[model samples]
Target: MGNANCVFCGCIEQASVGVVEKWGRFDRLAEPGLNFFNPFAGECLSGILSTRISSLDVKIETKTKDNVFVHLVCSIQYRVIRQNADDAFYELQNPKEQIQAYVFDVVRAHVPKMNLDELFEQKDEV
Candidate 1:
């Protein structure tokens, strides 16, 4: 996709949106389907962002009240909202990294106050 030519033709799969730029600036968005653009006119397809649900697991290590080191794996489900597709494409440099940072902060704050027994008992609750 880095290589450019006079005319660029591409397909955006279902549940995905294409980010288009003109003169290296945001021009418009391309919905799922075949799309055509004239790159010679300073137009290009910058990226494709998915609008479907996605998930990831973030692991964090923290110590409990008993000084026992516990490793926690948290599953996070997320997606780019349809209405905020532009923000998702432009605002987030690394979406997963930001999410993991947030989750790590939250878990690190709470886990220190809990004992090993409580953490084990509330495994499903977590």
Candidate 2:
């Protein structure tokens, strides 16, 4: 009864792709245009899921050599790079999680090598 637009629907609907599945295990045709669907639907849905490139923004604070604290915000965008859509989804949950894990690892690996002054000077390198 809820007529909700596809969460992935956008102006680029033309470029949209479809995923064939059952419709909530309910043996009923919810909509038209479904290519492949399980007729006897108990708890399944035929839908198209979209995977898009995502970015994560992280802010890190460190003290400067002059004893002043500074905060740095880094925005990083990363995609699955892999062409396998299913594999990418199975491997990477979402953009935020990927970004947080990657950025944290990167910052941790390099932060200790530099002091506050060096950290400030090399901020852009990150």
Q: Provide the overall lDDT of each model, using Cα atoms, as 2-decimal numbers.
A: 0.85, 0.49
Badly placed stretches (over 4 Å) of model 1 are 1-8
Q: Each candidate's root-mean-square deviation in Å?
A: 2.7, 7.1
Encode model 1's per-residue lDDT on 54-104: one tens digit a residue: 998999999998899999999999999866887888888899999999999
Residues 66-104 of candidate 2 have per-residue lDDT tens digits of 555667688886554323533443345564766677787
> What local lDDT does model 2 show for residue 112?
62
**Poorly placed runs, candidate 2 (over 4 Å):** 1-52, 62-70, 80-82
The TM-scores, one per candidate, come to: 0.79, 0.52
Q: Model 1's lDDT to the true fold?
A: 0.85
